[model samples]
Target: MRVFIRIFPLLATLTASFCVQAESLSARLADPLATEAMLPLRSASALAARVGERPCASELPASPLTPLDAVDLALCNHPQTREVWASARLQAAQVGVARSGWLPSLDGRAGVTRNFTDDSQLTQRNAALSLSWLLFDSGQRSANIDNARQLLDAALATRDATVQSLFLAALQTYYRAQATQAAVQAASDAERSARESLAAAELRYQVGIATPADRLQAQTAASQARLNTQRAEGDARNALGALANALGFPAQTPLQLAALPAVAAANEFQQDVDALIAAAQVRRPDLKAAEAQLRAADASIAVARAQGRPTLSLAAGPNWQRFEGETTRTGSIGLTLNVPIFTGFENTYRVRSAEAQLEARAAQRDRLRNQVALDVWQAYQSLTTATQTVQTSRDLLASAEQSERVALGRYKAGVGTVLDLLSAQSALASARVQRIQAELDWNIYRATLAQAMGALDYSLLQAAEGRP
Candidate 1:
């Protein structure tokens, strides 16, 4: 009865402890945010079921979506973003595993035996509990924990970097779609002008004031304008498909994007190149991840060096046995010290390998730093060039509009040739296309610069969209 009471309490305690540990580990592994992020990518129906709402697309307002909305959708639904989050969670669990090394481990055993002899029979029952713990291991335990923690930090930074990159991609795609839509409008206007010229030529020919060649030329221009309009519409549809893909939706998903905002003044990005580079170095998540990896490598070297030294551990065993109506109890506690004298140069090689890894990580970090600076410089220059192009294209568009107006007026007054009117109309169409392209380029470059600086986010999209 006493043995049963004693074993029951121990078993109960062990079971309770195991349940608590299991619950804690489960909580650590469960990530609601990542699960939510993955839901949209998996199926709209599933997301609707989970949230008790309609699909995301159906719930969107009827009004055209802004770039910020697109970026938000991408962040929520993109597999790439979810992948990073999952990786970070895995790394966090690894940190937990490393921490567990500090705690003692216990094992329980039970056995029953029966013996038969010529004149005797015997039954035996045994139970034992054993525990082993590392009392000291140089600094290897601490070093392992630190290495795991640094790796987790790197994983977190990598997730942020992925988010920034995906946001930039979605933003760029949104602007491209807007630009193509503008091109369709411009092509429609050109088609209208061409039709008007064709009408005038037909009327003049019927009145015997226009030659057959003039009528034929006007007809050709009208046909070309119609073709151009159709082509522009096709391009617009394709751009929308691309935008949908960027937003982590199926390519054919319909998206109504708001018109692109006007280009901002050059002064908005007038910070010195050196200052921009410094900001990028400080803010870039990829660079931070690299630095974290370097720290982990350094910690690994410490672990390897510690492995070559001595270790101290503690152990305990408590056992009970019942045989033929007799009972016995045994318990023991001991300390052990182990020194690594030699292992065919295994420790030496481990230290050497760890050092090499540390060197490689240091080199990689330096390379990343230089690459980050270059990214900032390149994005900055592109933004500057795009800003200038926006200005020049606006001027050209204004000139072309004026020229087309004058040519149309002169044509109506019988002072301008059909060729001159057609040329002016074509120039106006080209100017419109150029202006749209330039504006989109400016916005895309701005977003790229922010991404390169690790500052791309929904807020940046809001600011860019809010600009005139």
Candidate 2:
């Protein structure tokens, strides 16, 4: 009874702490995983109620989703996004695990036993509380803690990289859907032009001015136009389905997407490639994650070496027992020093393995560093080409539209040949399709360049002021 009273407070505190070291999922909400660098993820996390005061709607809104809206939906609702964030949280727990190495351990036990003798029966009651703590471990605990912290850093950076990748994907899908819808409109207009040309040919043939072959050619062109319209409609639906899926909706979910923003000159991203690569090396989250991984690997080497060193520990406990109508209480404390005499070369092998892993991490970081440069180079060039193409395509479309109008007017006045009218109409249709494609490429490549630089954020949208 005396021993129990002496350490009861410490026992109570240890019991309270050891009883629940983790929060229950159903009892409370998970912690936030987004960092300041991940703007989209922070907004999405709030939208999904992951880190916000109130729950948000998983279902999309009734209004047409803009580019930013789509990105938010994807970041909040997509499984891949949640997976990486949860994984980062898991690594955070691992950090806690490593830190636990510095703390002492305690245990409590209670038992009642009935012992039968030849002539009588006796009852025994016993209770004990034990505590053990490590005083020194040759820096092993520090190294492990460092490794865990670096790993957590890597996990956070990885989460950012994944969020940026998903952001770019959402933007690309949105632009593609818009482009396909535009193609459908262009195809329908071409079909209308074809029908009008057929009507003219029919009238001219009946008036004995156009040949039967001309009428037949006109009919064939109209049929081809109709076929093209149907195909375009099909492609448009596919693009919508893909967009819906990206936003975490069913593939068949009907989505009303807002029109693409008007294209603006992206002269801001026209900086030197070398300078851009340098900036990316600093800002890229994946590269930062790689650096953290390398640091963690280095810490592992220290952990392995420390494992072979000596460790000192302290142990203490209190005991209470009752037997044969007598009560006894006792307490004891002791210090222990442990020396690793031999480990059959296990520590040597472990050290060598850690060193090799560090080397491997260094090589991988170098490889990724080179890859980042190439990605920026390619994305920059692609955006530059797409910008130029968009400009030229607009010019071509204007010229072709004028030619088609002139050809149709001349044919109606009975001065232009049926072949000339059909050729102009075809040229106009092709030019419209090309221009729509050019716009889509330009918009997608802009997001692509931002993603390559590891800076796909609302700032990119702000930079354009009206575009994704």
Candidate 3:
């Protein structure tokens, strides 16, 4: 009775506090939008301020942005990166949950009972506190902990891989946007050259030096060049939109990109394929994640095997009871040994299943290693081809320029046919497009090789920005 008196006020106080909190929660739930559901939309200026404060947000000196700036923006703003980061955090919490198996647990219970028999009523009240600790579980606890730790490692690696993938995507899109902008300029130049040829042809026809057919052909070429310019401009706009999307911005956001530099010397990327393959094996995050998963699968096998073994535990409890006005206080301490005798061969089948999963994981790891090596090799070859194409395209552009100039000079001197001049002009236009595409392809393939080797990062973007 004395003990009950001492605890009664505390219980009543706790119950009152809980009731108040529950009522408050109920009110909030009834009008959830007022408290939680209705979030205020951030203004553009607020969003800009928030983005400006982030370390990864680009600090642009002007409207145009460098490749490094674009990559920084993507890293900061992209949802894919944030999603993977959140997943890693969740896996870390799961690791904590697994490790808690090593600690003891406590629980409290309370009950009341009422009975009526032979016109007499009996009432009972019971309260108890219990503690349980698993002293040993063969090796199940350790195995589970190991499994969780390995899974955490895998999640972290996967996050890194996702970041690298986003970087690669941003780089490719940036390059495409830059290339398309250059194409627009090239098309404008073509239009100017076509107009000049048309003017020359018109003067020649006025002076009876060229036929009407020549003037019509020149007109056709100029119109075609104008059309090409329009098409190139549209492509540039589309590419810019894609780049914005890659940076996790609205597709309609205006973005100005810095011009790409000329290709570097051929010796810049000279390396043995075997060396690259070895580097990929060391640096590829996806491969590392696969290895970690295999380790986790191996740990799971240990956990399954331990299920058939014995577990040692300790339990303790204290109780207070009142039945029909009689009171009793009781306490107990016990050590329990649990051994698995038979569960219809469940444990055996579980062990076998775990072993099978381990084999599958090992096979997957092996396959990923092979795939990584193959990717490195393929990227290396493509880079080599792209490098060679860059040189060839530059040479072709120079030759076409010289030929066009000579053809124009011959036509003005009244020695060359209009057909010859038109052919030269067409060749020049094609060569310009080819050179731009070749350069773009060379840069993209280089970035792809870096991605395959798991070396794509802001440093690579900086290096690309510094290229001549």
Candidate 4:
């Protein structure tokens, strides 16, 4: 009982944490696609049962959207994406805060004080008017304002980067779902072919042409094939769940790809690497945001250095003091200058810190540039490989299909055994799987290329469709 009592608080804390985590679906709420992606998934088996699907636009009100049209709508409506955008807005509002320093500041004061000496008496006083304005700050206020502006630029870039990442995730999940679907079909084919082989073996055994061992082997193969099919089915469901998450749909909602998009033929002309790098250098959100951060850091250095200088302020206030049989009203206006003579080397350290921060940010910007270049190069190579693989896989699939047809014909003509037919079926299934995998790879690489180019705008869908 003592041990239980000792552990109770810890257990309670853990339980509380878990409950809070479960209740906080805040991440999905921030997604831009949460609402619109839920519509078609609501009827799908994988997504519609676990987590309550997001409500569709039409269900809520006057809404017109197709599956394709829903992508942007979902992005815009996603709670997470909206929150990021809202953060950008908040950062922009902070600029106002920095700018306000340039304006006059007013204060009102009212106080009541009790005397602790002699007879206990309360003193009440009120000052209703005040003024404080910065006449000069050695450019510190201006530098701070500049820093705020640069920070706002960084925030905007960060928001855009978040949007890009979300869309890329969605695209990857879609391609993965498509790949799993193909795998399921391939597994089904394998199962069917195994069953057919088992039947052939049984017929031969009954006619005394096949041994019991052969029949048993065929039966085992059929069982394994059935297991494979079941596994594929599970994988496909899991893929759907992942896709739903990427698309910002609820876990319980069902998801289906709208339709297989037609891929454009590869262009004969190759884009120059230098040109692509230049484009990325100009437009990549991470790079631009990093540069903004570096600029902000530079401004921060200025602010830190300025903090060591003198500040001049114009001040004016009216005071009213009342005493026994005496009343006094005082008005004062003065220019006050403040210079920090000493503060335990605080300013010196601050300036050093700011300079260090600036150096760190500059280094980070350089690192980001290098990483982006590498990513672009890798994506370009992968895209080229995917294009080649797609064409090759298609040709191989066609050849496998023809071979299977020929094998089936030979078997029906009594010139081929069931094993030969089964082999052909297996080959055909593999070819189909490969072809599907190739297509998925192509899509993934293409998406990566688009991302590297900072050209992942959904509006490009029109251009994508028009290509080839």
Using TM-score as the measure, the top candidate is 2
Where is model 2 more than 4 Å wrong at Cα? 1-43, 46-57, 462-468
Model 2 residue 52 CA deviation (Å) reads 14
Between 1 and 4, whose lDDT is larger? 1
TM-score of 2: 0.88
lDDT of 4 by residue, 1-468 (tens): 999999999999999998888666665555322322312221112111222334333221133222333444345445767676666666666676777788898998766554565766656554556899998998898898899788878877777777777667666776787788879988998788778777877877888776797678778878988998999899999987765554556665576555566655485425998788778888898888999999999999999999999999999999876654366788889999999999899999999999999999999999999988988888888888888888888899899878877876665555666667767877887888888888888878877877887776654554554431
The true-versus-predicted C-alpha distance at residue 282 of model 2, in Å, is: 0.9
Q: What is the TM-score of each candidate against the true structure?
A: 0.87, 0.88, 0.86, 0.78
Q: 383, model 3: CA deviation in Å?
A: 1.1
1 or 2, which is superior by TM-score?
A: 2
- Tell me how many residue pairs clash in candidate 1: 0
Q: What digit string (tens of lDDT, one per residue) describes model 1 on residues 1-468?
A: 999988999999999999999997886567522322222232222222223323344233467887756766766677786688778777877777778788899999999999999999899999999999999999999999899889988987887787778777877788888888988999999999899999999988899888999999999999999999999999999999987777667788888877655666466788889999999999999999999999999999999999999999999999999998989999999999999998899989999999999999999999999999999999999989998999999999999999999998998888899999999988998999899888888889988999999987555655666632
Q: Can you write out model 2's per-residue Cα lDDT over 369-397, one digit (the tens) per residue?
A: 99999999999999999999999999999
Each prediction's RMSD to truth: 7.9, 7.9, 9.2, 13.9
Write candidate 3's Cα lDDT for 1-468 as tens digits.
999999999999999999999999998766533322212221111222322333456433365877766777777777777687677767766776777788899999999999889989889999999999999999999999899889878987787788778777877889899999989999998999899899999999999999999999999999999999999999999999998887777788888887666787375777888998999999999999999999999999899989899999999999999997888999999999999999899999999999999899999999999999999999888889889888999999999999999999999999998889989999999999999998998888888999899887655655656532
For residue 297, give model 1's deviation from the true position in Å: 0.4
Compared with the true structure, all predictions reach lDDT values of 0.83, 0.86, 0.84, 0.73
Best by lDDT: 2
Error of 3 at 345 (Å): 1.2
**Judged by lDDT relative to the true structure, which candidate is superior, 2 or 4?**
2
Error of 4 at 175 (Å): 1.7
The CA lDDT at 375 in model 3 is: 94
Give lDDT: candidate 4, residue 317. 91
The true-versus-predicted C-alpha distance at residue 274 of model 3, in Å, is 0.8
